[model samples]
Target chain A: MKRSNRLIVLTQFFLENPHTHTQLPYFVDLCGTTKSSISEDLDIIHDVFEQQGLGMLHRTTGAGGGVRYIPKNADAYDESFILELCEKLKDPERILPGGYLYMSDLLGDPKTVREIGRIFASRFSEIELDAIVTVATKGIPLAYAVASFLQVPVVIARRDPKVTEGSSVSINYVSGSSRRIQTMVLPKRSLKEGSNVCIIDDFMKAGGTITGITNLLAEFDAEVKAIGVFAEADDEDEERKVTNYTSLIKISEVDTKGNQMEIVPGNFK
Target chain B: MKRSNRLIVLTQFFLENPHTHTQLPYFVDLCGTTKSSISEDLDIIHDVFEQQGLGMLHRTTGAGGGVRYIPKNADAYDESFILELCEKLKDPERILPGGYLYMSDLLGDPKTVREIGRIFASRFSEIELDAIVTVATKGIPLAYAVASFLQVPVVIARRDPKVTEGSSVSINYVSGSSRRIQTMVLPKRSLKEGSNVCIIDDFMKAGGTITGITNLLAEFDAEVKAIGVFAEADDEDEERKVTNYTSLIKISEVDTKGNQMEIVPGNFK
Candidate 1:
């Protein structure tokens, strides 16, 4: 393959796999290149990546050590990408029989999840994101991915404390979906005062969880950097409450009779 | 930084932040290079990564278009890196108050979790991992990360089938720690017949959950590629049952009275 094509393929590999380690000898065999050539190529690629302000390539020395690409700016995404994602969110087929949206597939797709995480990471890169907050159980994966990119910890707000979690600080907030008061809590030491937090979740119906997370952050005297969601139901009025937030896909309106759908960018506005 | 260093750093950035859309203009700005130079460097780095069998880089054109790195050979890692990880897992401080190992911190650590996933992925890369198997709550994240790397689905075996899951296939397995018979289950269609499986969990005390997952996979006539755990409590005979398992840390013994401990590789043998 030409050097240019090879570079593109390689970049895709690293992007797809995060925090992976491999040896140079293995690559030398795979690429049909000499060790010296592989070393020189690595030098060139390393410089280009750094110049791009993407992050740093971490190299481990010795026989077992190799290179790992780490992103410096986690949340960078084009506006059009967000718009396209929003359009998909509006698809009527995604609407379930009972008004619930089918989102398990999107959450399960690694590529989509990665993009969703990057968009948020880019937006919040400048802020000191101490913790990525979410409620169980759908929000856990997104929260974990975003927090991983940011290299920060994620605090899961449970509906009820598990015996495993020891003691926790609880709060009561209005549920956006049920439109009733519900309680959520986290361990006292899980988050500190005056910390910067990013609230993320899988779906947004009435923004109750968002509000709950916001209130919880208040308890810690923390600043809310931004709120992000995988999908937002169209019927809800969540956008009015939060000034800064990002959603990969937006649900516009669900056709109850025909099962058709419409969606637009909630973040692009 | 030199062009070489820039390339390494840029590659790292993409790897760390997977599935992101980054513009060339941003890369140019970050590296203080012209668009042409950044493009050329990207070409070189991409080639190196591919030749090394590290990953693949994808480029999209037009407005809001950018490059993304996808991991190809992420399952490949040096044996020594695995050894070092095993060493770290042996830390005495990891012992909890009870006989249990304090692995929640490790499970919650993104870097550690990513590494653990890579370790298992390396062992099972060529085995056609159909679905990652694990038991409830704590094991979910590890299973998720592994499934993410393998680009496969994860079937969580619930301790008890909740009403939401509908029907399930249950199995009775011996608990490794408690030495008591425990039951675990998976949804009927969760695993296909004659599929290849990879088992992952947070902790393997008596190897009960691992065995449970194995038995569940057997119902589908599936073959297990390998078993992986975040930490293994190194009590006597605990390590005997698990075959082809990898653990990041090991707790040989914990003395509650003196708060003393012994740590080593739980499955090194």
Candidate 2:
């Protein structure tokens, strides 16, 4: 194959399978090119990938070494994206009864969710994760999105256990706001013992749900490597259950009567 | 930039934004190259994409015309991939107490779900879809996967209502097996009127849930352009409710005592 054609094929492989190491001989057979020529192509691709801020095409030598794509986002782009998200949250039309904000539309958008996943993945890029764990329904999309870039499987915790998941480990936790006891279940077969995981959620209030998830994962001996939240409600007066976590956006105030809300960046460091 | 570097960047662009168009002038400025050079690079990428069964880079001329990537699947590859999936589905260990198949592992896999989404996207590639709809729980991941390839938004219907979604339109439907009335909710603002949608589900057993989705979409005056199911039960005598649907795998039998399963390819032309 010509270098141009190989470039197209190589780029597709990297984008589709991030964080997976494929040896040089595989590409040699795939592109029908010499090792030296392939190396030159990879060098050019790596430089362009870095310059474009897409990620890094990490390469290593030796018997068990090869190349892998580590996805990353530029700091400048992430700043602008988070700011725009805060601005969207400030929309008065989003204010609903009982001070809740309507955000299903943004979460429903594939492009927007993909960008959110990219930002979260970039933040947790330094950590080694065996799986992306999240609760059912809303958090599932965000989990899959981050898992795509991290190249790991997603383990979902459901509020109710299903017959299709076989035996499960269930945990009960109290709701922060409602002060109601709720059950969270994880199928025993879904996760392995002592696995490293990152917990993702769409929103956080008193962190009761996240705290519940952390307790549930402990049943299987899985480590909660990191916690990433899309939005965190700002309530400094109320004590929070989970103290160590990262949030992208902070919703300072939700004024239902005024039909307006105050939004700001989260404490992400 | 050199042709090699341009190839890298253009390939990344096409992969990330499928089903969208970009004019030649945009590429000219992006690659820092002449229009002729960019055209040559596109020709190379287009040919490779088609040959590799990655889809097409459709080209058009004139002021409003540009190039778009239309994703498609080759029959030979699709057949082999689906067959392999069936073989995996036939694992005796997947048998639960009541003939339920343990499929959470497969659904939780990002790569596997991605390929499943690609197949569904290819099946409905001809249809112009504004959104992909699916009920909450297991179906959310599949819906997002298909929406990613189709470059459309995902609208999810839930069994329970949440305050953050604002006001919603709820519908009652009979469960296919249990014959119990269940409520399905879709937020009013989640979808627009006269929108074309594709309904995707993780599994279909009498299609009652899908029928409910269709009825709900009717409330918003949306059109059900296509329906895709990951797996369908081979209970021919049961008499399914919804017709005119595509399935990738047909689970013929699940013998709990025998600890074995019979699986085959689904009804896809």
Candidate 3:
């Protein structure tokens, strides 16, 4: 293949498998090129990634050394994107019964979810994550997105364990919003013992659901490395059940009768 | 930036925004390179995509012309991958009551989901999809995956409408396995009228859930362009509620009492 063609294929491979290191010999064999040529191509790719502020490309100059891509920090949420998302979340029609805002539209958008996933992955990138954990329904997609970037498996905790999943471990926790006791279940084989897990969810209210996930992870001897959410409801009167967690959007107020809402960027900003 | 660096950045941009065409002049301004250089880079990227069977790049020569990437046919299911996945599904422990097989592990896996999404995107790439439609829970991730590749949004129908979703339309459909009626809901604004949608789900049994989604879409004046699933149960005795659908894997046999299962590649093979 021509040099340009080789570059395109190489770039695609690197982009698809971020954070994975590939030895120089492997690319040299794949492209049927000299060692120096392969090295030069990688240098160009690395320089471009840095110049565009896309991510970082690290190279180890030794027999075991290789190239890997690390996405930028998730804490550095793009200012324009967050502002636009907050504006959209502030729509009056989004206000529902009991202080809640409609966010499924934003969560379901591929472009928005991709950006959110990248942000979360970037924020938790420093942690040693064995899997992305989340509760069933809405949070599954968010967990899957982050796991994709991190190249890890996603493990969902179900409200009701189906027989299809075989044996499982169940836990009971009080719901923060309803204040009702709810049970969450996870398959025994879904997560490996002693694995480092990053918990994610679509919405957080009082943090009861996340607390339940933490309890469930303990049963398998797994540790909760971090917690991330798309949006979290902020209330002055009610204390949050979970303390250490991150959110992209904060719903400061929701007025159903007044048909209005107060939205702002979360701690991620 | 150097020519090589420009090529990398341009390739990354095109890869990120597949199917969206940007004028040549736009690339020239972004890369600070001449129009001919930009054109040359695109040509090289397009050639590599075609050569590698990764996707397609179409360039318009006229005023409205630009470049776009279209994924290839799902029928190109990497032979080894299907075989390996089928083998994993054949595990007797996966068999459950009523001939259901456990698939949460495969569904939760980013690597597996990525391949399945690519196959689904490839098979339906020809269709003009406005968005990917799916029910809440398991199908959300699958829908999101396909939507990512297609650069479209995902619309999820809920089992029970949450107040946060705003006004919604609900419908009743018979559960093929339980032989009981169940209600499914979707928000009014989730999908636009006259949209061509592709429905996706993790599993299918008599195709009840998919039929429900199709029924729900009709209320919005939308059309079901196609349906895709990760796996479908094979039972000659039971007729599927919906027709004209594709599945990646076939559960030919599931003996719950005996703890035995038979699996194989589906229509895509």
Candidate 4:
């Protein structure tokens, strides 16, 4: 393959398997490229990654150590990218029959989710994250993607306990939508005490669920590193409490009455 | 920046924000490049994506369209990659204090989770997944990761009901570990009827929970595309009903007697 082609393939491979331990010999065998070729490709790939300010590719020297891709910056999503994403959030197809945004497709797409993960990973790259926390269901993917980027374990705050979890630490917080007390819980040993945590979720409505997750994290003596959301419902009241946070897309208003919508990038300020 | 560097940065940008609709004017602004330069860079990025077999860089011309990165073969994690990953699964740190393998970290890591998602995505890429299903809470992340890669919405089967979810469809399945009948539920409208579904979870002990998820999927008239697990308990006697599956690691024996263990990749056979 041409050097350019090889560069693209190598970059994709590295991106696909981030933080994975893979020897040069293995790459050589897989790609049918020589060890020297792989080495040279790595150099080019590393240069490309650094030049883009995307992240870094670190190669471990010792036994059982290999190549691991780590993001050099978190919060790397710029204004234009966020704006473009917010525009897509306005798509009518995203609107469910019952006024809910159809986001499962976006959540499932690897490329989309990876990019979303990268945006948050870039933002939180500086902070040492002990865990990625999210409420059960929708928040799970966002939490998983962000945690995957940070290479941290994720703890899901369940709304209710099930036998599968054995035992859990429960917390009660006011639900943002209902303004009533709602409960959430995490597995008893899921998170370590006094750990730094980043809270992430698919959507933030009243910020109640996040507060619930925040309380759950506190119960473990974990510190809040930062908070992020895929989309934040554009409500002035809810936006007040989520002051120090990042949102990929901000839906300012969803006019179900007129079937119209307004969206913008939220609080990257 | 150099032409090569510009292309790399642009590629990273596009990769990070898939399905985003943005014009060349915006790209020019972000990169400080001219419209023509940005256009050229996009071309290079597209070529690189295709040549690498990563996927296609879809561009929509005319009004209200720009670019989208869709994985051509989202399920293309090669067998060699799976084999190599099996080795990493043997890491000592992965072996926990109580003979439990610390898989939450691997499952939580974005890159590892993406790779894990890809492995399953590649396996079930052609299956037309309607939703990725899992029984909360550990399975939520895995289901989300896989569903994200597949670009489908995930319908989480909760071990119990919560008020927020409203009405739900419930099913009873035998818990593999406890060998007890456990009920799992999903919101009534969460999944569409007759949709193809892929079931995923962080770990499987007796395959009972997955079976529960399968039963829940069926309750909505959804079909199972495939079943996947991050880790499967190594014991052989636990008969699993679902045949189409994949697992990154399998814990055959957790030796509490000697604090030793045996870990291997299961049934990618």
lDDT per model vs. reference: 0.67, 0.89, 0.83, 0.69
Please give the RMSD to the true structure for each candidate, in Å. Answer: 9.5, 1.5, 2.0, 7.6
lDDT of 1 by residue, B1-269 (tens): 55555565576566554445588898887777787787878777667667665665678888988787665543334445556665664565544344444444555666666666655664555566677877776777777777766777777777776443445799988887667888887766466788788888887766767877887788889899878887766666446566668775665555545255565544432
Q: Lowest-scoring 10 consecutive residues by lDDT in candidate 1 chain A?
A: A70-79
What does candidate 3's lDDT look like per residue over B73-168, in tens digits?
Answer: 324446567789999877777776665677888888887887777878888888888999998788888888888888889999988987777788
Tens digits of per-residue lDDT for model 2, B63-158: 888899877878788889889888888878888887888988888888889888889998998899999999988999999989988999999999
Tell me the chain A TM-score of model 1. Answer: 0.69
Residue A101 CA error for candidate 4 (Å)? Answer: 5.1
Per-residue lDDT over A1-269 for candidate 3, one digit per residue giving the tens place of the 0 to 100 score: 56676778788888788767788898988899898988888878877776676777778988898887777642334666777899998777777666567788888888788888888887887788899999988888888888887888999999998777878999999998889999999988799999999999999978889989999999999999899998888877689988888888887764435366688888876
Which structure among the candidates has the greatest TM-score? Answer: 2
Query: C-alpha displacement of B64 in model 1, angstroms?
Result: 31
DockQ of each: 0.16, 0.90, 0.73, 0.23
TM-score computed on alpha carbons, candidate 4 = 0.66
Give lDDT: candidate 2, residue A66. Answer: 89
Name the 10 consecutive residues with the lowest summed lDDT in model 2 chain A: A252-261
Q: Decide which is better by DockQ, 3 or 4.
A: 3
Q: For residues A111-223, could you state the per-residue lDDT of candidate 1 as single tens digits?
A: 56665676666556667677788887667777778777777777777777654455568899878666788999876656778888889888776677888888877888989
State chain A's TM-score for model 2.
0.97
Higher-lDDT candidate of 1 and 2? 2
